[model samples]
Target: MSDKAPKPLNLLDYHRPKRLRLKDARIPPLNAESKRCLRNLTAYRPSRPKFPYPQTRSAAVLVALFVGRMGDLYVLLNRRSATLRTYAGDTSLPGGKWDPEDRTIEDTARREAFEEIGLPRDKLKVPLLCILEPFLAARNLIVTPVIVLILDNTLRFPFSLTHSPLFSPPLPRFPTEPELIEVPYHTTNEWTYPGPNDTTLTTRAHRFLTGREAGGIKPVFGLTAAILIHAASIAHARQPDFEVELAPPEGQSREERIAWAIYSSPVFHEAYEAEEIKVDWAKVAKTAGGKGGGRSTRR
Candidate 1:
């Protein structure tokens, strides 16, 4: 009656109080699927028993998994900086020892990825794929490798000169050549050898052989190779199209040769150089010597 058309009955006015509450309410049960999934995934228990071994001796490894739309999968590996004291210039996965602040091994892996490669781990849709048994390397350190998935493509990573190149463009489009998917593994006992000057310090090398009988020398045998072998197997099982042919050892890249020279003492360096595989050390040095940044050297 106040000439405002009765103020257009407030939608809340005519409805019964009970009807208002029932508009969009539906109670969910305690054992819903969402709750079950969360419970199963969150339930993690470490099996390592307390021991007298120095805390400093323990380490952790992470296998960062990135899968493409066509189902092509690749593992993130990093070449250690020449300046690092341990495993300098060695090609290995992005991971390191755990810290007191880390809530779990997954946390350690995420933290190390961010520190070593400038990647934000939170951007990854990481799901705990599986856990490998702890293994000891010649360095006398215990390591655990946790596999996780990277589902987001929008995330960007920053690379430093010390760290090896990132798999730019996000690992070739899916349905990658079967040969590319195949990774070979060999016995650790056969590969582990003592370094030049130190009888106590030793290194293991993993030779990756492409079908063409051409390959690069990967100095990550022992635990690292074993981990890769296991990962390849897992990926193969999940993807029937993935196939790799085993071939004999081939050659080493110049970068790899240089890294071997720097990390391994003169004796090992000479031995590696004398091997059948030929490396262009001068070219490698030149490639690594450039000043231009933010671009990849890999073909």
Candidate 2:
């Protein structure tokens, strides 16, 4: 394969000289099934997550996903600035500590994104999917992982969205016409593929970095890897993979194993035992009397 970068896949006038499909508009389109898989992940609550350490400070991170040009999905990741005091230069989901003025952890994620990187609120219009089971960081921080969706094409956010719980099986929905936008070509060199040419970063993430092939690729340890594994599993499982020999001691299948992985890790167990995990839905959503909402632990 050529080592050259792929030509920018701008959708403007893109399908004119080729085949046209209803989804061939600017920004990517997601069907009902994809949304269903995501809902299942967001609503997943582990019975026990390790408790957060009392001495730890609280922080949160954003796991943002967007559809790629070829209909594949890509999660946002940043190589943290090397100058920071800790976890500096590590690959991370965009987020930071909750501040007094922020309405919720979701707000903190978006606000930090704007403050850390330059994702202006105008350019990014992500809808809050839901928060994942919290994970504890090595720094003694209880961290909530917030999931958000990047809508295809539109620059502004839709005021409100409604959807059912993940319990119902997903029914297929067809693509509706989307408002189009002409994205001008502006190239930057910072973007790099996180995995090998043959496989996606999603694949390497689920198939954890537990082997000799660990060189060169930035390590995605513990919670970050777990979140990616969860999200990537949902994204790729639209057509399920064949069963693997690996089983979680109880002889459960792949789906069962995926669910089990969250709580079995050290973070969840420690957090649960320490009694540091949050249970109130409204509190976790940051809608209480203005303070004291938190979630966390990891393996």
Candidate 3:
């Protein structure tokens, strides 16, 4: 091995959010980006293991990303069964408690996803590209977000009218347990990435809400939404077209606020402000004086 230390990234300009895109099939490109960019990614170590209690339960959620039927990217989400004892009927990523049989938290994520949704082991490509910072859900549990990418070629659809990773066999079969059945997976409820012309983009000021009694999607608020937004942003980095706009907005949607909170969480902010993630992504505009790196950034 060469005994050379990597050169540091020059952030004077990288700090500003710019439209970004990578022209490659692989998400998070298997090959290393420029040395500076690659090295900067190393600086971001998600903040966790902060608590000392051994009995405190540890949980993991898979922020599974894949090409959708129309070629656009989509993530998997589920509504909790109304009968479940906790957070029943809430929308969430596929996951659960870390199991002793699992070798790592990532294993917990995959295992739970398999048990809960029947995602075949063959569908998964990269088991883990990176792990985001751990979050404490509204409840007391410590939850970790695991990012997994599906093989672009493995997914197939009946027809190619508009998307990729054809999501045929529309819904996954749930386990026999009635409690698990309460969630009742539906094809219509999955969150759609807002395209450029999406009506939601028109305002950029309003929050997307879920009406519980109306038989709509379970609201994606708080930590879950934050993790998703974070994943979506990173997923596109490998595309030759990904870019961030340089602007800020007054406090608006709960998502921008929550995402900013996680990104600026004491641990994340320290690494970010230091440009450990490469460029100093502008502070979310909602902050008192900082300009948000991305404005109205929709999937």
Candidate 4:
């Protein structure tokens, strides 16, 4: 890898070109299946989560999709290096926390991918499709999923040794008929957090089982699994094969619960404000209306 930084992406190349220079242009024309997936993602409007304070704990993960041998879309995944202390050897999308130099969240994703797997930063190689709504991770970080497509399926690069390109089951088949996921698919566990006036606010944890591997790669679960499920659902135009709703059925929505957590946490506030970022208390009050769990014990 070169010590020289990647060229900052220009605004003109910020997104996928709306129309090609020529209708018959075959500068490597994508197959019909790839085109369909791109169309679905581009048209999706994801719900955005709001907070009163600046999201200094923000991060972005790249959901790089490419057409597989069977003419179906597949998501590229990485196996984290075992040398890392956190989530070591776990399978996850390539991403990291937002950096001060990042001009946009999309740049954060692209930069992380380039650093992790030697993927090119040029939009000509990997084109943006869409970015999904922000997801609240157990760590209190707001994670945004950025979707991109690998233009050349056969293109090769000098990826890190720890960068394993695992092809998820074809998008259409997904969790519905995936041979990779376990039988029960996902299970939910309730977490109780101490709330104001000594009230107990409960949140649910959804964990999916990815079958064991001989190479010591941990199963995908938690935030990574949730992101994949959400992304695949959008790309394939369908819901997961198993139930996704977390219990108790009457509990506060995930976004509302997370907002309340951030709003109520003095520690989170002190850290966020320490960065000298402006706080929007009115929006925070509006979004974090309900009293619920402030944070999750697990990631």
Candidate closest to the true structure, highest TM-score:
4
Q: What is the TM-score of each candidate against the true structure?
A: 0.48, 0.46, 0.45, 0.76
Per-residue alpha-carbon lDDT of model 1 for 1-299, expressed as tens digits?
22221111111111111211111322123233323322332232234321111223345677775544443455666667768887766567777775655555566667887788765665224445555545454454546666655545565666744745554222222244444544542222332333222322233344432232233324454456656654554444332233322221222322232233333334423332333223344433333332222312111
Residue clash pairs of candidate 4: none
lDDT of 4 by residue, 1-299 (tens): 44442332222233444532223333245567566666788777666445332336667899887766655676777778778878887778889887767877788899998888877787766777787877677677777888877766566755555645553533433454345454654566766776444456666555655444555656666777778778777876888666554443334455666566667766557655555444555566456554433332211
For 1-299, candidate 3 gives per-residue lDDT tens digits of: 53332223221111111212233334433323232232333233444321121112457787765544444444666666667787766676778876556556666677777666655444224334466665555444456777655655554323211111112111111211234344532211213222111212111211123324265555565566556545544443332121221133322233343344433345433423333233334533333233446422111
TM-score-best of 3 and 4: 4
lDDT (0-100) at residue 30 of candidate 4? Answer: 52
Candidate with the larger lDDT of 1 and 2: 1
Could you arrange the candidates by TM-score from highest to lowest?
A: 4, 1, 2, 3
User: RMSD of candidate 1 to the true fold?
Assistant: 22.7
Per-residue lDDT of model 2, residues 158-223, tens digit only: 211111010111111112112212421111111122221122222112123312123333445545
- Backbone clash total, candidate 3: 25
> Comparing candidate 2 with candidate 3, which one achieves the higher TM-score?
2
- How far out, in Å, is residue 289 in model 4? 3.5
User: What local lDDT score does residue 236 receive in model 1, on the 0 to 100 scale?
Assistant: 40
lDDT of 2 at 183: 25
Question: What's the number of clashes in each of the models?
Answer: 0, 14, 25, 0
